[model samples]
Target: MAHKKSFEALDRTQQDLRGNSELMGGALVILFGDFRQTLPVIPKSTPADEINGFLKQSFLE
Candidate 1:
């Protein structure tokens, strides 16, 4: 698998998403990390790891 890039460095892009919420949706808000903050307990393996885990266990098995 290819090494994944971090979106942490793209905090500005998330800010743009928030600023454009009307163009996005009242339903969604995007956010980026504060590198000053600690990392997750187990670092994520991929951008979709958390969601994929839930879906695989719950729906697709």
Candidate 2:
């Protein structure tokens, strides 16, 4: 699982995401999912808590 801190690091730096340079150093990252379709299983947590874990706050999103 990806964390917010890691994405912050990438966002802080300048990256060239063109041609082979895209994946030359770091892996090309992508996120695909619909919050309306599914939600993560946070056992014993309320819906609000689960929603709080949303990745939208991360730069990777």
Candidate 3:
């Protein structure tokens, strides 16, 4: 039997993903937030301009 520390490894992986995703916004921008809750510490961008591009070439008809 092997003792694998999964949770500790996951924290580092999640941190890296968050850092990398900060710069990407060209694709489908899905922002999951609650208006009743406080705002985020990091800045966020809405892909309103990219919406037209995505909709024009989306999978849905």
TM-score of each: 0.19, 0.42, 0.25
Model 2 ranges off by over 4 Å? 1-25
Which candidate should be chosen as best, given TM-score against the real structure? 2
Per-residue C-alpha lDDT of model 1 across residues 1-61, encoded as one tens digit per residue: 1111233223335547666433222334354445233233326466466333332223211
Off by over 4 Å in 1: 1-42, 55-57
Order of quality (TM-score): 2, 3, 1
Give the better candidate number (2 or 3) by TM-score.
2
What are the per-residue Cα lDDT tens digits for candidate 2 across 1-61? 3334545555444254432333223555665667455655567988786665545654455
RMSD of each: 12.6, 6.3, 16.2
- The CA-based lDDT of model 1 is what? 0.35
Clashes of each: 0, 0, 0
Native RMSD of candidate 1 (Å): 12.6
Return the TM-score for candidate 1, rounded to 2 decimals: 0.19
Model 1: residue 9 alpha-carbon error in angstroms: 37
